[model samples]
Target chain A: MSKHTSMALRRPSRLSPDRLRVVVPILALLAMLVATGFLQPRVMSYFGFTLLLRYSLPLLFATMAQLCILVVGDIDLGIGPFVSLVNCIVASWLADQPWLCGIALVGAIFAYAAMGAFIQYRRLPSIVVTLGFSFIWLGAALLVRPTPGGTVPDWLIAATGFRTPLVPMPALLAIVVAFIAHHLIMRTAYGTVLRGIGSNAAAVERAGWSLLVGRALLYGAAGFCGVLAGLTLSGLNTTGDPWVGAQYTLLSIAGAIIGGAEFSGGIVSPIGAVFGAMIMLLSSSLLSFLNISTDWQLSLQGGLLTLVLALRTLSVWVGK
Target chain B: MKQIKFASASALALLMALGCHAAKADDASALKDTSKSGIALSNSYAGNTWRQQMLRVWQAAAQQAIDGHIIAKTKIVNADASAPQQASQIENLILEGWNSIVLDAASPTALNGSIEDACKQGITVVVFDSLATAPCAYKVAYDYVEAGRIPARFIVQQLHGKGNVLVVRGMPGTQVDVDEFQGAQEVFKENPGIKVVGTVNGQWTESVANKEVAGILPSLPKVDAVIGQGGDSVGTYQAFKAAGRPIPLITLGTRQEELALWEKLDKATPGGYATEASSSVPGVSSIAFWVAQQIVAGRKVPNVVKVSLLQISKADLATWLKVTPVGAVASPVYSKEWTIDLLKSIAANTAPPPSPGPTQNK
Candidate 1:
């Protein structure tokens, strides 16, 4: 515990690349929030923040899931479809048979872990395997709920609907989840092992750590986050759709990247990923508040994303 | 020539007088001053030709209403065909304090929560094309079941109830697909002579339909007729032609490509190629716009308003082909008068007014 505290507290220095990486996303997020607030002052209020942040919950979880995979030098092209499948199960089975839902969710986690083992053992490219699995996940989701109608359990709805008088429920949940993820991934010894494997697999193996176990554990964790995302999405939407979360795979990758996670692996910021997710989700709201024409909204959103990434690159250069 | 000119002048005068009288009647019944009311459109996706046409139609209609002092302002927000994105857009629309929202939803049930929130805020919500199941929101929708039944009926009659048929379906797991397939099955089940030898998911696109049909065509026996959801008829035709089989009687959609194909095929054959063309018009967005405006103006509108599908018979095919531009869906723009008449007919349980054909562009 002392060692973990020291490592967590060691990042107090100014002008560090790691610190700058996290700060850039936060600054981008704040900039977007200010721009939006300037345009629509109503959105500056408590109710306004609640409305703006409500839909970001699922995305935040998904981005964390992607961050887990990215931390281990693997990319999950299947996260979106996996989340969609979980959404189908949550909406269809959770209300009717909670036991079945539990079993199915656990079974999915194992499936993800097994996929990790298979890919590692066979020395297969993760991108190819995950891409193949995406189709399988989409097909399974369709089989579970062919159409876009399913009843989310009342308890689940109430759970997602939980509101606080002070901070909005979604914002509070986002911060809590971010801290938990940050603690687990940054302060835990096992997280170091995961990161070690990503940076130097042979060194980790030479250190008597099992690379297979680390990869499987991280993949399982990702699966768990994906399931959470799907459940929260179902609760919020109050229904299920097999195709609803299809856009999330790319969004999560972008969020993870924007949040200072690297494709080269061994680097991720849980809190930054949450902020990154918020930035991505709220930019559209900002555009909407600005009353941009519908034809130009999408292009402007892309431009904003590019701008944020450029800022991130500039921050890294400054830190250097 | 002088006599003809004088007669036309009197007819034009009578028409103008009648038009003025209709305007006077409409003005007297206007309850609320909607001149200060604002309406917004929350569209789910603007990716496809159909949705693009729908947005264009809405923009034109909304601008006209604004210029005519029917509404104070209008705005549009489009999402990326995702339920969560659209739900967020709807929430933002509510916060923006729009008096009315017209929606082309991404999903029927996924948007209910946001729709309910909008309704609770006292916003007039009108969902069209792809509708929401929320009780508070009004729906302006197509009779997709009837849309299915008509073409299937046409195919059954043409085949004399005895033929091997192929069913080219729309996107799987969609309500529209289910309804249309159900309606087609109802007719086919009633007639025992028609055998549905094969079925493929066309996904309501020409390229996908072509590939799916081509993949399934080799194993099946001779296909006498093909029944398709709109947008796939041309593809089904192309698939059959590529396979070196004689083109059978394939039902057509209202796509310009389909109509153009119909014209080409009709002229090529000794006897005219006969097939029916029918699909929901993208201009239904204008109807939804008008519905929202009328509701905001304090007019009583039904919770569910049905718009008729645009149907093209053999004789009208030439007219549709003439006016329909390449790569555009054949649709007649809906006017405010037409929408009011539609609402009145729905309330009175009578047939809605007939949709006019597209005016020939010089």
Candidate 2:
């Protein structure tokens, strides 16, 4: 074959770049699904889109929240406890008052935001402070809803979980959030400041933007998202179980890393984190259907995360 | 400089303003000095209403004047379930001069230091449901290991010494988990026929048990029964519903809950395990109150209290007497006053431990 002919044939396909990017992961997931189906088709149906969404939304919101912190290249261990703290608050106080839910919920979100701001101002390790904060808030939450029996109001749950006629509202909201995130992150000065600080806070320090302010804003935003997810789950169950928020801490971190977010400042995206959460949720539910052991579910999650990281690394290298 | 002056002047202004507030606080503290003493309650919610019930039970216990001993006041601090939070709360409460503590601690190990600290400060400590690493001034709650053994023995006999039985357990790394699973395992070791086919942590929630059971269904063989550790029994039932499968189910906690399952399984009556929900919390609360009494009176309390667990089937639901006394709005409300009164009684009694009662199956 002539070199020119070979080069012409190798030219990029007609598929849009964004479409191509989306299709690759979807196809990979399909292949995995088909393989699992051959092993047990029942497992496949149990973990379909809506079911996966049901499991993923909380973690998705959590990781999306974490993305704010990660974008600025800072870590906030407190989001985990923050999620639980807010959950306890909602579970105990507004649990019965469905009518006053909107006002109460909005007020709570502001309080959580203030907490995040305080942490940033203190310039303490988020892991330590958040961990401590978790105890305080959890203690406060339990002081109210000591037992685990209650149901979320119906409307909020519907708004969050419904997916008919092709668009899963949760995913759609995630996408909108992702786009808004992408714009704010890539287009705005705060986004640039975050990248700068994340990459080299020392350099950014000389660049004039306050690392403290960036961290506060990002973490506060992350916390707001965390509370949103907690509130959403509270709506799903209507009763707040205090321990519910604690589980998401590890799960959210796993989602963020698994979704292909890098350790460094420039590598995270809200969209990627959500996709990662969806995949992890789907995979776990599928495993549950397959009757895999809890130990294996964790090992598999770790394994999948490694595979995603490897693939991301390969993609970057090959593209370069 | 301006910020410091503004802050100090505001502080001075606030100090003068708060001087008036201090008068009220001093008067309030003075009034309580002789009549009412402060007590702190710490616990793990474990989804078992026992700890939650303590809040109410102690208040009731406090109401009883023991030999003209004015049972001044009580404060309830709960962790819901977190070990770390309870430890911190203990520290803060101690700093605030709470000299007596009743703990249904989150974990046995987590409470050791706090208990020791309380003891050092001349604070009387009472622990139950789970114990501190060290013995308390007094301890009262069901002997968890024995509780497991009673249920295990019956379930093993019903399983006919051999079958695949799933054990749905409570929180991991907890005293309840340690003691109950330990006792149950000892019994299982003796009976080779009883195999622990699967074990899952339901965190004592029905929904979790339901999901875990559903997750394991395809891999699980046809099983004889499930022995859920705590509240997750309901979820295990739900799992059976989700999986479209059924087997005889034996779970514990409340009588009504058990009967509820039997009712669902038999398709005969409304689910009412009259014994479990009605009796379990209040019974534990009764024991805690007794333990608290030992501390307040400067007397030794037994290391453990054991309540005979009742297995309520559909057959028994009809005449099931709710053990937790009746109160307004679920009248058998486990009140706090019972705990304080019970604590004083146990503390006052230094005699040999009384022989336990017959297994009352109501």
Candidate 3:
């Protein structure tokens, strides 16, 4: 609690990176809100919030999965397929045999954790290993369901599809997720060791923290988040496509980066990551609403991301 | 000198007649040797239910041909949506000595070189569905532009060409979407009163269409009609139902869900709501198979045969739905005889290509 209070009191001079991480994403999100209000006034309604944030659950989960790895100074290239595999499993088996699906999900998490251990033990490049694992996950998903047709369990759908009277379900979910992840990654002592290991592994090692165990936990947490994300997505659509989450791999990385998590630095804020994911998703909808051509829309999105990232870099340099 | 010239002219005419008879005999022999004819399918992608149904139709047709001794064997190689891979697959099929290669190309131009190479090797290349643009290949694709026009025109007629319309488009920048959109736009242009209120990209999938339509439903004014490409009506219907809005006249696709909804609506709503469903049925691949058989039998086939979209009216919805299983695709049932007749008519240049026009719902 003292640590949380101190974090809130930290000035820009003391914690510039933490503050700058969320600045651009917040600004971009605000700009989109303004644009939406002007371009389409009805999106300001409660229904509009539900519509805008309906498909964002999967994205938010993917961001959390990626955030876990970024905190440990590694990346999960297989996050897309990992989420896709979970969706496939949930769509086909979970609704029928919840116990079996639960066991399989646990197995998948173990696999991810084992992958982390293998990488740490063998000193292999995580990028190559995870890239290889992505295919394995995709192949598994395809083998389970060739084409995208399966019914999500009624309970899962009901939970995801439920809307509060005024507050959209996604905002409520995001708050819950941010709060939980914040405590797990920021408030906990293990989190401090995780961040400490990321910045200076030797210092953490000298302090008697096992790097292998830490990596395994982080990867395990990532797997759990991925499953949650996949289930939420499947719940949202009440169907599964093996290839639906392919875009999420890059989006997750970009969201984490945009949220203030650097590649090598142990700079990740849970709330910032959520906002970053929202901003990334909002831009896609914003472009469509603006009546941009499909060919130019992707380029425009890339340009917008580049602009925000450049802003973040400039601010950091100036603050220093 | 006049008598000599006349005699020579008669003799030359006699020789020409004999040459024609010899060519006829050659074609007869080729037809008799149908057991030696082999047709191979080069598929670009088999990822969706439509492609699955297409493969089934092709297999059933190929099996029939094999049983009738029209073709010796059939081989199929799916490239999993890769253009270069499909091209190479076609190349390999040519090398394997197929009499004709029926292809569903990934792109109009990417497979041109491979298709031309096959044609050069004395193979009849029949491109269908997503067709290749090579002159050397015979294209047997449905006019997707016409497919789009049928729905737009239906909506215009139903709404009396004056109403707010919402366009639920397919994946952005896709050829199918572009052609369909252009056709709809052409109809809308002709009728100035039919105002397009808003357009949303449905991504050619039900869930996407549902989500996008649901998202924009609040922002849109009271839509009198909806113009959609195939695979979207179910989503559009679902969106309107969720919003508790009076369902407008929607263009249905091939999905069983869409057909089921159409059936339900036909019974529930008075005067059947003036709705119609249209699409290029996946079983049209059987038409491609029949065309391949004709080319292999030494029939002089045309460079292109355009198939029209199947528009199932509200009254005829049950007939289509009867054959379409629950959760399955609504594909046309093309019998072997029907395919052969279609192929023969097209080969003989008797069946004129369908001109793009306003499709009559009746």
What is each predicted model's overall lDDT from 0 to 1? 0.88, 0.60, 0.79
What is the Cα root-mean-square deviation between model 3 and the actual structure?
A: 23.4
Tell me the deviation in Å of residue B129 in model 1.
Answer: 1.4
Q: Write the per-residue lDDT of candidate 1 for residues B1-362, one digit (tens) a residue.
A: 99999999999999999999879867766657799999999999888888888888898989999999989899888888899989999989888889999999998888888888889889999999988899999999898999899999998999999999999999986789999999999999999999999999999899999999999999989898999998998889999999999899999889999999999999999988988899998888889999998899888988888887999888888888888889999998888888888887888899989897676422
Show the colliding residue pairs in model 1: none
List candidate 3 segments past 4 Å from native. A1-124, A128-320, B1-32, B335-362
**DockQ values of all predictions:** 0.54, 0.03, 0.01
Deviating ranges (above 4 Å) for candidate 2: A1-30, A33-48, A95-122, A161-163, A310-320, B1-362
Candidate 2 local lDDT, residue B211? 84
What's the lDDT for residue A223 in model 2?
64
The single-chain TM-score for chain B of candidate 3 is 0.85
lDDT of 1 by residue, A17-120 (tens): 78877888898888888888888887888878877887888898899889989987889999999999999998899888999999999999899888888888
True-vs-predicted CA distance for residue A319, candidate 3, Å: 63
**Better candidate by lDDT, 1 or 3:** 1
Candidate 1 is graded, for docking, as medium
List the candidates ranked by TM-score, beginning with the highest. 1, 3, 2
- What TM-scores result for chain A when each predicted structure is judged separately against the true chain A? 0.92, 0.78, 0.93
